[model samples]
Target chain A: MKHLDRREFLATSAAGIGAAALAGSFPALASAADAPSFRPEKDAKLDLLRWTAFVPSDQTIWDENTKKFTAATGVPVSIQSLAWGDIAPKAALAAQVGSGPDIIMGWNDDPFVYPDKLVDMTDLVDNMGKAHGGWYDNARSYCYDQDVKRWVSLPVGCTGNAVNYRKSWVKEAGFGEFPKDLDGMLKLARVLKKNGHPTGFALGHAVGDANSWTHWILWAYGGKQANPDNSIAINSAETVNALEYARQLSETMIEGVAGWDDSSNNKAFAGGRIGMTMNGISIWYNGKKDTPDIFPDFANVTPPMGPVKTHTVSNNFTSAFVFKYSKFPNAAKEYLRFMLDKPQADRWVTEMKGYVTPALKAYAELPIWTSDPNITPYRDALASAKYDGYNGKPGKAAAQALDEYVIVDMFADVCVNKMAAKDAVRKAETRLQTIYKRA
Target chain B: MTSRSPLLARLDSPRVLGYLLITPAAIILLGLLAYPLLLGIWLSLTNATIGKPGEFVGLQNYATIFADPIFRGAALFSIFYTVCAEFGKLILGLALALLLNQQFRGYRASRALMLLPWVAPTVLSALAWLWLLDPQFSAISWLLIRLHLIHSNIDFLGSGWGARFSLIVVNIWRGLPYFAIGYLAGLQSISKDLYEAAAIDGADGWQAFRRITWPLLLPITTILVAFSSIFTLTDFQLIWTITHGGPTDATQVFTTLAYQRAISGGQLGEGAAIAVSPIVFMVVLAVFVVRSVREK
Candidate 1:
């Protein structure tokens, strides 16, 4: 057998890796520039891959705008839409394999996970800063890459999780308005349950769905998850009361609500089964096509305070990053600039209707943005919104290790089932401690 | 005396050639299948999460699986689902096969349609079931409610019993065709002469079937039972597509739990551990099946 020399093979592979690294494709540097659709001799080609579904709200409207932008400047654009969950693996693999898309959208929270894979857009943010009035703090915080002292994924829509209620149901329940606080919510839930409209914070197995629960409830009760110091403050009196309130709410809920995941709740609400729910308005927007009866005269409000504080949490808003594999960094910045521009951003806000809130402040001045009733509340909420993990260490492993859904379930076991709240909290806390310690 | 070198070399020569011919197959097995299996076994003892390589933590994953209420519940639920589902399939498939085997006009055409449910993709079947099982739009439940068989619409996938019962129905539906086809093959293999001999011995149709038909089908029965047990125990696709071990993890099986640990919770090591424990049970069942069948 002819054996290969280990030293030579290692040396050759290292060199190849180094050469690939310096090539600076994905996870390296520079963004891709858009080119003419039909290869024009004068223009350069660029690709834009977004970690968001290019829905009617932003991408389509941008396509119309891109036509005009192309009319003036003869470069072409290609847009790739993907789910946010698929972004990192795609980006990472594209980097490793040397064939990733040029410009990809990521949530502001994404830089923490893959900072090296993106260009430091701090200069881009600073450069683009004058053109835009301001950025939402929560959305902007996640885009900054502290490692390189620059911004990464440029902020787009700013969303805060809120309670979406049916105006028709509130009136039928003998309530003049949406429940303003925890007590009001409790009272309204009991009223609604008695009146045939059961209410609940629909629970199920989805991990991101669990985060929405954590932010609106856990944070309200002072459950601090900021690490390297995870204090299981979720076991306090305020939290116990929150859990108790959750339990009482559970009692007033429809029988099958415990099994409802996000889509299931959306179906429940759309069918007028659930009186209200806590989740993203994206579901509400997307549901209209299939379930039009579901979206009528609905009111979106800041998640009500639980006798403590009404805090908002969103898993993330749509975000983008210039991949290291980019062929044209300058072109990517230009596209991001165009994305933030007036009729473009406003059209996204208007067309997406209520699905997204524009990251740029001045878009609120635009006609379509201001005129939309369903979308306006989200704009107001983001003014005071704190991103669930904005600016913090990714702390994903720690938080995951804690397994918030399972923890919340355990807590709910005590709170709703009257399984001894202290015992439940203690078990959950011990679990949290073990997770945090391991992390 | 034979020359030592010539004799020794000849002993090795043909074996080396045989190994050489099988080299590609061996390499592929090692690289693709065997390595992953061994790696999974290794991972089961460790505390590996996704993306992060983990430290070995002895039998902690197995211990935790037993200690966790969720796993214990899932295990019992899985066993209940498997036993009920397999038996239901066996009974239904056998009955269906018997009916199809009877001489009748248009029986050949109807026999072909029976294979559709078995052959249809699990995802498509699940989607069909999802529609039929929806509380508001469920065709079956709606019919039952309309006919006053049930007072109100029952949430078929909500309650534990409802979900388990629903799984039994689906599992039976999916597995019936295999059993039916297997029984048909077994039935066809039986010589008509034996039945003729039984009839000549003053045996009635029922008595002939009991003595001649049942004994002949024994070997096939053992094979079918063993095959169905393994297949049913390892079943994941249909139930996952239907409920994803849903509403309360009420439909939790070992596979679903393993999936949650691996994908949802990102606990690969724990999942690998959970995934493998079922094999021990399956192996024991398989051995018992083979041993009993062999003794007969």
Candidate 2:
């Protein structure tokens, strides 16, 4: 104004811009500050343990979002990432010892396994649901314990499984597109095998991929692990049919399908070894980034429908539990609140490139799904995605069965070991009875 | 010097001093090893889950495990894996030790390089083997296929027997260097005069090995085999990392089975029982080994 120095003029302009930015976000800032439920402890610090993201960009997005929380509130958050399989046992040990991180994210039914040791987060759930247009049915079922009337964990997003296939290979195998039904899928698999491009999914103790697909197939064939009352209902004609169908399908798959884990198919597909496998959008994302030449060759379709019905299992449906032993429960809750807020959640969803199917209804309109046709199938799969216990409520028994690979072993017995389907079903039934009949 | 009390003087005596010196180590062992062993035994007897406190079930877990087929299978497989891997390692290690003991070009360098497999971290080496034996994209498979030895990739870690074979091969590969290096040290210690004396007495190569080399290396070999057996019997990381006792529990050894029961299945008591079941066998074997070694 009056021949001001360069430093003075620059500082004045920066202050003016800062004020304008603050004015725009003042309402949100004021509301957060005024809300009694949002109050954090005076010196709250948090330690959160979560599974390491398969996609590198997802981890980047997670780190960036957590930094925003630390910037907003002067609280430092430490995030410990571990392998997916390690999370359950580690969380169990922590609960048993009555000491661990403040918040630990695990698979569905993890809360039921140690509900007594976890803090009831129903208030946080109610608040999030009210703000985000209510939780999805599968999400609610996975996180809520109706008998106890407590939300032991907060329902977060689930990763949807779909058939990631090579478009070129499918065309070469005389299929213009992916199979829409299980019969067509089997034909396609056989043709792919004939064409030197076999299709496969994990048949072994792969906790995520194999379990999800095997359970989906069982449910599709009208076989249920338990009835509505949660009694053992595994040994049935429907289960035998499912196992037989799986064995037929296994013939079309590669020999090593019995040893495949959650990442095996992804690697196979990305390396141009297999024609198709059921997985999340991570494979597509990986191919898109690392193998750009083959990126366009990759495409995704929803899991094929079985003879009786179309049913698929959501591998993602992860949730976070705040232990009762947390010294700073409020801080953990507030951190989760900030992370699940619309803007932050949308950013994470966007960064994940549709790999994370949102649990909230409001996130259905995220631009990532609308912008890419490949991602829309995953978004749609979320609507019909079923939890671990489809007909029965997910509880400690179901969790234990899943962890023990009882269902996976049943399928493997028929497919890999060439055991009779009936015998396999009986084996699974006996195991389930032992688990559910326990006091 | 100031006069000392009888009690202090007694404590300063060499015999008392020895016990006094070992007290710290004894306390450390009790805290780190002995207490955990006792707690594990107690846990094995209870019906503990992960988070809940278990009551005294009085060996019910043990009885249940003994009746379980998977535990039985794992026990049998553990012995098979240990005996087979130890046998392979001993033979290969002896061959390597004898070869390396001879004078040759780059002998020192070759000897050092031979230790790479044993010196490298087990987990890292196991991961490398996992890649090498991967059903798809395995370098070894590629080589074999290229050589027209096989029409397609071998399912090295897919089948039960294939996985067992792969694990034993890896174990032998890792353990051979240790045995070779140990035997080499023993081989070097055998004086040249003894070999010359044997030669002067009309002893051929086989006779020299039988009379002089075998007797001198017996102590080292016995100790090495015993140590290797204990380690191989309780092996977890190699099997866990490669197969995770999978393909229908084919590769399931004692430790992996215990892990599956206790940690993954949340049946801590059952897992502990499976883990401690091998201790009795190991203890008896140890006693037998000690008696045999001492007698010789």
Candidate 3:
């Protein structure tokens, strides 16, 4: 549970710094020297399906990296960027029909949904782990299939969530900085609302924003969807406590947050309607470009500490998985390796302005985290991050509960529907039981 | 010489040619509609998830979904949505049709303008409605506030009932033009002489409409109602684009639920079951309406 301060983080990343040094001296040579090479098939071509990123530079740099890969290796790669919500159905259909883009950069637990259909990336992952410092434990949880004893996917990175608030507004609300604990957050929210600037969080079926903070709050209150044994264990006093807290929190929010999706809060924040919301760095990035007047007034910080006094993990994690049905598997593997290598990943992360936190531990020392003091907190976003299932295994059951927005709805039912906390907990428990039992 | 062959001669026969003439249409229907419908139903009866061919479970998926509160809510909501939207569209469309049928100076232009909602893409229109209903940035809210009608913005999609009502309103708004245009065509086809005849018998406008117009329009109304009911029951895009079935799933319809479970959740069988659950309602409605129209 120890958080590494900036100084300590930099100090502990000696190995990462060494890799950076090598990359600086001979970027091409160092990458080629350490990577486990794959000989692409004759005339191998790859098609990659990726979600459209929130930060514009993420895609621009990503496409540039892919072009670099093609220039280095004689293989041609085509990338298709789809909306965030559409990728899941497309990936599922591709998995079901046994044909699609050779590589899919899918969201959390997507590889778990169709483990058997994905290509085994064990060697590629092991080599990458060694070449970099190592993959984070959370990334391993996402990409590795414990049942199969193989890595079914390679984690690309995660888009971490943080509290984005107007600095001036926080000061006006009688806070020096954003609150760091549950009680303080509630007080700050109340004050902000009184000051005519209420905080808003997505209470709807937002795939990213709602799930991220809701899960964080639930887990922070020591509630979980299931136990280590994967049993339904959500009907607990802790869950009720979480629900009650959410109910109190919702009262301090803008009027329509319950119906808001991922984009709603962003618009609200940029339009100066809400004082605070949890989101990725896209809001700050986009605000800098479009709303320069408001840009200096806002700041980003880590999510508030719950009563448990421990930081809980929450993020919109992403990973890449190649399907077994792919005709050019080696080429796909090579392309992933080429993109995830330090030389390319460093640039992508740096250009993204810390929008995407690296899944590999080695990239923690990337300049993006240090250059901007505002983006410093995001560097540790995945440090304590865990997979979705948390206490249980990450699998279809967990993914289903997530896809159905079980936890988000549990909090929302109490917050927006004004259902009794215990009743909402019972309802969520039943839904989770149905999903887990079915799975 | 070629036509003298027995097969060619048989093809020239009226019965054989009649079958041959309808072959393509039948094949197309079977291929496009029947095949997918059967596949979906078949999938529903299995334990199919994504990527794996599943074993038959024999309606177990149906039992599971029926017991699910979310699915049950979606089922009830779909029915409510269909009935309410259809009635609203029918009544309002009939009114618009009647108004448009009048010989106003700009009747042609007004009719064309009225069709914009239906003619515009559903997704695009729904997106516009999303902005219009936005709790914070809504133009309607701005107008209402400026008019001093309400002191605050209406949280259109914030609560369960609010979201449900908003979705139904949007559905009606988008679908009204279809009903209006169809009823207009039906109204125009009615003879002006019938009204003259009713007047000769001392019938008022309402009485004349009840006696003549209602009877003549009943057939078209039945057909329109049947088609609209089916479309509204299976409605996906408008609700999905607007809410994604949120506010505790107040507006979750069968199509969205099916999509969430089957496509997003990767439980193809369960999703298929949810998708096909509305077949009974649709079929029963269709048959009853068709039979009633035929009898009348």
lDDT of 1 at A194: 86
The TM-score each candidate achieves on chain A is: 0.77, 0.91, 0.92
- Overall local distance difference test of candidate 1: 0.65
| Residue range A359-405, candidate 2, lDDT tens digits | 88788888898787788878876687776656666777777777778
Expressed as tens digits, the lDDT of each residue in B118-143 for candidate 1 is: 88988789778876776545689789
Best candidate according to DockQ: 3
Return the top candidate by lDDT.
Answer: 3
Q: Which 10 consecutive positions of candidate 2 chain A have the poorest summed lDDT?
A: A27-36
Q: Score the docking of each candidate (DockQ).
A: 0.28, 0.57, 0.79
Q: Model 3: how far is B152 from its true place, Å? A: 0.5
- 1 or 3, which is superior by DockQ? 3
DockQ measured for candidate 1: 0.28
Cα lDDT for residue B135, model 2? Answer: 81
| Model 1, span A1-439: residue lDDT tens | 1112335433543554466468752221111111111112235456776755434556667667666445433557787767655564465455434566777765534444445656666655654454567776755556664445667777777554667777787898888877667788879888888888787565444444545654566555544444323454445665565566667777876654444444566666676777777767665676567677656656777777665555545545666677666766655655665566653555666676655666666665656535656656666656656554322343433334423354446544554345676676666666555444433
Kindly list the interface RMSD, in angstroms, of each predicted candidate in the order they appear: 4.6, 1.4, 0.7
lDDT of each: 0.65, 0.82, 0.87
